[model samples]
Target: MSLLGPILLAATLAVPAAFLAACFVPRWRDEALAWQWLAPVPALLAAAAALVAGPFDLSAPALKLSLRLDLPAALLLAVSALLWIAVGAGVLRAPAAPLDRRVAVSWLLTLIGSLGVFVADDLLSFYLVYALVSIPAWGLFAFDPAPETQRAGRVYMAMALLGEAFLLAAFVLLAAGEPHGSLRIPDVVAALPVSPWRDAALALIVAGFGAKMGLVPLNGWMPLAYAATPIPAAAVLSGAGVKAGVIGLVRFLPLGIPLVGWGEALAALGFVTAFYGVLVGVTQPNPKAVLGYSSVSQMGVIAAALGMALAAGDAGAPALVAFYAANHVLVKGALFLAVGAFSARGVRPGLWSLLALALALSLAGLPLTGGFLAKAASKPLFGYGFAALLAAASSAGSALLMLHFSARLPEAWRYEATASPGPLVRFWPAAALGALVLPWLLFPFVGAVGDALSLAKLWDGLWPILLGGLLAYALASAADRLPRIPVGDTIVVGEAAFARMLRVGALFDRLDAAFSRWPAAALALLAIALALAWAAAP
Candidate 1:
């Protein structure tokens, strides 16, 4: 493909996005929702070309916008485009109700950010795209208008704003450290190893991106958000939106150089989160909440792989992580859609349910699935060590969680016996099949597909899944004995914190009210001016 091709692809995202903004006009607002599905087409084209033609870059003078498409990014961009297009269509086709324009606008903005992040070539563009992806999706929760939805939105916004704050600080520190003052990602990352603020920069990057990935204490927003969001919104948010953080880790973290202490620290954290998500997930009754925790767990495993790669100075790790994330993008999106499908009645039980179960198990690395290929491909990074064992255990945990998800399918479907299977069932099989097959085709270009498919590799993928299945069966048989816990375990604790915040806000409000009196305001202004003048004297 020519440079113009990639440029065109990048431009495609903004045009539809721009139209979405224009929707604020009364005349256009309603029509924009119907048109929103087209926004991802350019991204889909760019990703397809990038995969076929190899990587490409484009630049312009006026705005200095740059785009580079490589294997990892292409893999993510392709699948993300697929999910956004499919889900956007599903949303539009669903029974028309009173649609919130604000929700539609937020969706478009999130789509732009989600697509743009995958192709962004420079640090500034990446940051801008990342912000777009994170900040606006709050509207999904906003439109539901329930107390729980409001609370979820509040937590989601808090974490997003916090992440952005950290990213800004990290970006500034990175730019300051660059010897040539270049703001490109490659330039800043090249400078990262020797920079004076390398540790600080890394800290800020991890904290910022970690929040988005839902690592541990930062994870409270995810379950709440996913549980409250509409199905279509949850589909893309879990599948495509969180990939912003994955891409961030790929682009920002210096993988070519060994940073042993930091790498090990990150690895440990990832391991903790992987196990933590499962423990909490199993306790929840809501299937959506379970899937949200599954994402948290799965992303943690990816983080652990990246951490290991960084420690060993493995440049190939990013491609491996991307392949893993790509499988997740499809499988998770399909599973979320499955939630809708399973809720449909009059669907024949045997084939559709079996297919749904198979797709759900794919996340556990069931044999021959894309998840299996992804797991096998990533094995080289874990090598033969404790990390490899941890990886296997995490896969087992995934299997357990997914089995639980499958078992709950019947309960979800029982409510609507007369309802047709809808587009969710019609589109889900394609997405699931795509997730299972596409990685194999891409594996040769990015990694050793033959190695990934080896008999021993197959066994490596198989045993953990078997173990997880057995464990899940045992848990199911003994279900009543398992401890009951609330959805989003620690979120209850967060509610207490929020209550404290209300008290603090009340105090601040009273303070503001007192200061607002004319005499107090004038006195405060005089005090501030006097303090400034005194400080200037030095």
Candidate 2:
């Protein structure tokens, strides 16, 4: 088992890399492109092995390879792998091969990083995989000629670079704090609380991962990016790619030992983002954009959960948070594919819309859905406090936003039928079905399914949804009165800031030109030499 564990871990990463390298060979490029979906198979196998084998470490002391698949990571890995496979199947099912070389390579690289993140044990490995998952995604949409596509690509890539900067700085501080020079996550986390750079590291860690999760200010890129990308790419990116942040929090933060101030601060920021996403989402007319805001909202809920757990000093919280996030990975991923499926059979009232509706509402914690199981399992961690009330209220907001999704999708597709939904329907529905059913299967791993179904518990899940539904109905007439915000709301500010930086660059350029004149350059060098000479003389 020990021997097989590291081999499986290595294979999971090696397979994608091998295929990605194969893409560069001209003769193999087409075939490699066609089989893009096959890349996640080894990861699926590795996740399964880890599920059975428990934590595994590679014996190479020099490489410092250590990987563990505890229940939290295993849960996320399984669903992420499943999302990749389902999306991949959708690609392969197309009559003509759907991938160009650029897209195919980008997809494979993103998949490798997405899956690698779950099992990454050390700081350097995590950072490299994290960058892999992040930076290459630009190629997915970068070449498109449309202005929004180009703009989305630019914004996304910029935000990704900014996030990488924050996380890299945090990792350096973390390594510095560790006297033993170990880069393993567990070791770094153990040293974080007492380390000299503890606050700085933790702050950067939260902001870094929070950017990936679509937390406010860092979030403006998602809506534009998703709306611009093709649906299948969006599916895996939303479902699998974003969870990298959640896992970062789960792995990086010192959750077991509570720091009340930091915890409360995180919880406060989370709640603000939670409400912010939904309120902004409600005004969005595009279903895809709505889902983007919803991601922001949903991720905020996850952040809030982590924050509360940290406040309580609960060691068991990471598992519960993982369980919640794992369900989202499936549900959100499936929802993206469902959008594609619905557009296929536009104007037809079939099982797809109904299924999509159920799935959308599931995100709002509809009773008996996987979301309910997730919410209930994590309920104890929130305890009886204002944070708990905020958690409950967030469900109302989820219900409201999802109801907006439920209503908007069918309306858009009611008259736009042209594409035959049948070709991809087979593949997409499998994802939707899996999302609905998998949480039930995973329930026992977190807590009992029966507890989620008790009369009181069912009501606990029911009221918020009812309130949101009623509010949604009440506001139906006033919907148009709501302001129409752009997809990336705060992005306008970011863009302006970037513009100012460019203007500053121009100013520097003019100064550099002046400095290149012989007299100017001679004076600068003479001043520097004189200062040095004077200091030495003194």
Candidate 3:
């Protein structure tokens, strides 16, 4: 490997690590917070290098660690680094102080982990960075004094830990399955198809990464987290933080070989989650919550595409999914910023509103936008089957949900005319514009630009969005009639179930205490001896 590649790759991590380390010094902490946005520069450069110069790998055998940047990883890393830089600059600017030390610490740590996961090539390293991406982020939202924010943070952390457990177990199985006991991700995944625990590993992998991506039953944290977090934090977490799971799935899944049953099951789950988000999202009053559901819906589409690819053993699915997800990373991030921007003023019929509408519909694959290309790129994976039809249908659903989100933004608008809306809010339009147009630059890696702009392709993208717009219009008149599901729909029920389980555990504790008595213990011992003796006689 060229020295430049290694230096860039190593610095991608080291620079962030250095900033985070400096946060420990009292004097440097403020400066660290002010300059934290710059930490992603190296990562952005590394991503550019990989994309232009091709994939590269770096290893430290003595330390048993490795890093690699493939097309999928590079695509995600570049956009994600952009998100971190843009959002971080707005949130952590010099005047934004006095930023809380904890929030700063959390942001830096989360930034490092978010960028780290894309390059991590080994199972152990991936798991560690994945945890970093998932865990410290609780502070981003939960540091607020609001009761709901605190609750959201707790729920987010619980889900993160649970997901970690699933991933760790799956990784252990993957490592064990490799006859050579290789820790490198590619080696382990190559062996996964024939592993004795293949089914079990795939199941765990789905459950673990699915939790991060906000798949159903586990998706409850997203609405609450996004709704509760500050807009800048929401932008990055929704944009960059969650892609850890996408990279996880892209890296770990044995996508080169078709596992028909598992792939079909995953795709089915994805479609279910997709429509489910739309059905629930339109009823939501909070724009942030609606966007959170939009993410849930969007992630479902990615999962479905991947599942389809997995089912067909299509090796090209990773890059296509990355392209799709890259669009999402920008769009969703900018939409959250838009919420903040729109909220800064009273609702009016003007350019801002028009821009908001454009952004919202873009998620539904409006032509000429990045989303349209993302959807176009994903078509081959589904290949005109029922899954393809469902994919198109999901775009319509996305349109309906996003339209609902745009309509609801006015509810968050401030009546105050005298106050400044702050830098992050001010930066929203540029972010939104970038989100819409930037995918054109990325589409070429996955597909030809000329093909994406063809008349048939344009119509293909338009129809679903039009269908969704019709649904939105129909629903708008009857909006009040739509059922209002709670922000984290299933989470409340899960909490109640957990409470009941705790009560049952208390009862078992009392029973155990009762059984611990000397006489009871002696009787149990005698019974065990008698049983053993009887078995021996047999």
Candidate 4:
């Protein structure tokens, strides 16, 4: 491959890292923040290279950096890069008032990790970038005045750390299982199926990635987290950050290995999450939070596809799955931007509502939309049976949930609309338009256009939406009767998460108090160390 490919790939990573580093320096900080919108340019450029020229590999011996971009990584990176740039614009144009430094730094840190994960080729680099992608986003939500935001931050951090721990163990097991000392992802995964610790590695892999993807039982954090952030932050996180989990599954799971038992179990879980998110989402009153549940449901569909791909031993699963997720990146980002902009003054909530309705239903795989191509491309993987039927139902379920989202949009703007709004509102239309048309350009990468347009295929994509629309209409009147589940439904742990944060804060307090008593602190440290040693002793 040409140096342009490798340079573009390296630049994609280096630009974000360099920019983030610059933000830490006092002199360049605000400028760096303002310029954060420009941060994704290299990534966009790299994606352009990947799209036009195919996959590229880059290695730095001294830095032990190995980055690889194939079709899957390229596709996700391209769409995700597009999202970051688009949303970053909205962030820059947010208001004339000085932007918050914390938000700026947080955005850059998150962007560094977010862009890095797609092309990261080795275990160590992946873990580091994955951590960047998962953590540090707390800054975006942690400082919110609302208790729900703080509570959500607590839960989100807990989940993120928990996922990190599981993934670390999995990576360690994977590395240990590979006798050759190779840390490259492909090499480690190549050793997985026959590794002595195969089951342990796979289990951790699934659980870790599952948490990030917002799979059920672990899904409560998403609504709280997404709803907590400002519009631009929420847009990027939903559209791009969440896809880290999708990429994680793509990277780690060895498709075409016929691990049927595990595959089936994950598929079943995915389907359950799919229905559960929709059921719960409809009850939610907040548009952002409802979209959060839509995320839960949509993510589950992606997971189910991965599961089905695993069961069928389909090597092509990663590309198809990435295509599905890429579509989501654009659509979800655009929708969240729309939600943010709808409340702006002078924007007719009613007219915007109509526009928003069309944008939101794209999640349901509306005909001629990006989501439809995503569904159609991957339909055959599930095949003609119970699995396929569930897949079809998921489209309808998505429709039903999105209709609920549309229904709830007005409620979000109930008291916020007006006749004069800021410049941020202007970007929404462009973002929404991009979400709508961008997928068609990328669709040819995943599947044939003729097949996507075929009468039977169109019908396959069409009926579920019709059924869902009917179902939505049927339920519209009864929405009042639908038991409204609080956003972050069943979030029993937010308090627990908050409690833990409090304890940690208290510990810091005690540490500060004890620091003045140096002798006592030393004794206490020695005692604590001995206690830890005693606990580990055989």
Candidate 5:
């Protein structure tokens, strides 16, 4: 079979989607939920095929749905597929509570988008896939309507819609610039350097993808969303859904061209976000919220890496960034799952929990783990410069935040029995094992395995971990002295801003009321028509 055969990719998406369609029959909804776990299998297969067979393209005759997968896309798709599978399995076994069909539907829709985004070969398909990934996931936030969840959902939706607006504008600008009317990403990007609206197009692209990537200022939604989600849902959203942005950046950004000013600006924004996430993360009490902040920080590091690569006009950066992001997909997903596991199956206070804790801390680039491999792979881009120092320091902050997470675990799990193993038996081990091993295996394909394991690399990975450990230990000793802060600090500030907007909304409501009066409406229409007539007269 051709490695990029549309059959496999189509099946991956279509089968589960067909099942979701079946859910319209009340009799099939439960059965469909049971089988939703199978939706990502085809995606997994397509990813494997793409990785093995190189890039391939397929197009439909009627709808013109172009499907293609390259090495970078396949790598991300594979990891994302794995996350969906693992999380789906966990969800199947989770305590039988009232299941939310809306959440399930959202999951399927997001899955389709997540899978499609990886293979979409043209601009219109990419936009459709991006929309699928962004819009439906809001249902995951809205399944239950707690204040935090509602607020988080609102923020997430707002950012997502804003991102969509920017990306659509960028896509429109890109299409307009294409002399041949080509909507293929490669074609558009090839023309971008010489395009008249290059600057505006790039700005829109950055803003659009940056919002999804949770870049600073636009990043407020992440902590709020992750903090409110169910553990399994959080795992997939954090691990897989967010990668839509990563892949978008990889595919959309013109890497061959050097745009020094723009690249440096992005890098600066990234560095600030990296440190900003940690600074806020340390203050938060919820482990999940801390992890969310950590994602913001880690993605910042990625943005910095991409910026450096762009500045240098390095083509090798995408694979390296993918490797880094792929590792994060596994580790962060596992960590979020671990939170649930540890909570359900009480850790025996000492070694067991400590080992789990240690593994969790590995997200901070702890030595001899997937996180280190990710960090090591990116080292070349940073190259012993200020960027390198900043990246390493971010690792230190990751360690500290993870330590706070570990400390919080005991309290969260205190009510459960330590002796009786719960769901963690099935869930945690798979997640942890995936986090530790998958990156190593994938490293050789994208990077040199020898570079990943060298003594110099080992030390580079080790010291930051050690520093974080020492800091964690010191904080533990002075635990009481630490002031308790709310999870998602700036989120509180954001909420206040939202409240202020509500007051503004009331004023706007009054304005609309006045504007809708018959005399006022007629007068506005007349004024607009006269203005148009005057402009046209010239």
Candidate 6:
């Protein structure tokens, strides 16, 4: 490719890498934190450049690394870069004391990996960046001494490590199955359909990435982790970092070929997660926790769409999925920032509350909003019949969950301190506005603007939201009667099981101790010798 493309792509990672490197120096550490917001600028520029310049690849044979930016990656990268910039600025530029060095370093590391995943073209590089997005992010919130936060962090780390193992095994299978020994992602994926171990590899790939996307059975960490983190960190992690799994699915799945069984199975799982989030979220009192559940639900919608696309062998599904995810990247991050802003002590909760409400409802595909367009863009994948109905039902579920989120906000505002809000708090509205409008600007890249605004399309998006609103109102009186599911619903069960396992291990330790004692050891040896003598005589 041309030099401009490579340079811009290289600078996306290089700028963040340089800043992260500078953080090691005691003198430059403060400076690094001060200007950390500027790090994503290159990525933003690269994303914009990719629009006109088209896809480009940067390869380093010596380093065994390759990076490519295509339409799907660029869509996500651009929005994610914007989120990182806005939230990073607010966090780092706050009027408070300087941030802890570790948080700063972890932030940069996570930022690099978050952006890096979109461009990484090789299996090895994608795995490394995905790890970067998933692992060091523990420092973002786990530093708090709160017991719940610590527990959440531990669970988060365990899930991340588990996901890594799944992905690594899958990658190995993909590599082994490739006859040419090509390590490039496209090469491996193209070969996957014909690979001897195709089914096993696809299963692992779905499970590995599914964990990150908060898909069912593996989704326990997401809500807990998000609720535990500070708002700014939550915004980025929820928005940008989580999408690494999305990109993984988009890149690795052979969408060009139909896999009816796998697609349907994945779609079924996605729908389950989508509704499950709503069922549990309305009962939640914590606004942050509610939003966390909303993410689970929304991600499920995306997964479902992708799964349908895979079933039909729709090669164009990647761009549509990316567009849907791109809208989510902004809206979710903005919601977190809005939470921080609304929770500020001295701020009057009136006007900001309405703004926050609009942002929240947008997730439900509110008419003419970015979410509406996102829903519209993905409509082709769902088509008519049961899948289409589920998509509408998901919108309603999102609406119900988001409305619940808004209802929980007043309580959050009431308990806050009386201190004046920071610049970051004030910056929230701008971020919210960006989340609403930016998708409209980018919608043309994926589909026609006129189609999203059609009378029929508007009605399609609206009824579900209205139904959800009615449900929220009807349930408001009985919300307290709903059982309180913990932030990570299934995680409590897992933890209890682990505790029991530990007790079992303790019993084994005692048995081992008894067996190791002189009398028991001598008896065992004597018994073995007698048995050997008997056998020899025979």
List TM-score per model, in order. Answer: 0.89, 0.90, 0.92, 0.89, 0.88, 0.93
- Flag clash pairs in model 1: none
Candidate 4 has a TM-score of 0.89
User: Who is ahead in TM-score, 3 or 5?
Assistant: 3
lDDT of 5: 0.81
RMSD of 4: 7.6
Q: Write the per-residue lDDT of candidate 3 for residues 287-347, one digit (tens) a residue.
A: 9899999999999998998899899999889999999999999999998888887777633
lDDT for each of the candidates? 0.83, 0.84, 0.88, 0.84, 0.81, 0.89
Give per-residue CA lDDT, model 1, range 31-60, as digits (tens): 777777777888888887888887887776
Show model 6 residue runs off by greater than 4 Å.
Answer: 94-99, 413-421, 504-538
Global local distance difference test of model 3: 0.88
* 4 versus 6: better TM-score goes to: 6
Model 4 ranges off by over 4 Å: 93-99, 349-351, 414-421, 493-538
Tens-digit lDDT string for candidate 2 (214-245): 98878888877887777778888988899999
Best by TM-score: 6
> In each prediction, how many residue pairs overlap at the backbone (N, C-alpha, C within less than 3 A)?
0, 0, 0, 3, 0, 0
Give one digit per residue, the lDDT tens place, for model 4 in 1-538.
4888899888888898887898778787667777778888988888878878889989887898899989998889998988888777656533223436776777788988899999999999999999998998888768767676777888899999999999999999999988899899999998899999999999999899999999988898898788776777788899999999999999999896888987898899899999999998888877888889999999999888889888878899899999989999999998877776765543576666666777787888787888888888778778899999999999999999888887766566652222212445787777777787888999888888887998888888889989999999989888779986777775765656878999999999999888767887788998999999999999
For model 5, the stretches where C-alpha displacement exceeds 4 angstroms are 1-4, 93-99, 413-425, 474-491, 501-538
Q: Candidate 6: lDDT of 86?
A: 86
Error of 4 at 424 (Å): 3.2
Stretch of 10 with least lDDT, candidate 3: 412-421
Of candidates 6 and 3, the better by TM-score: 6
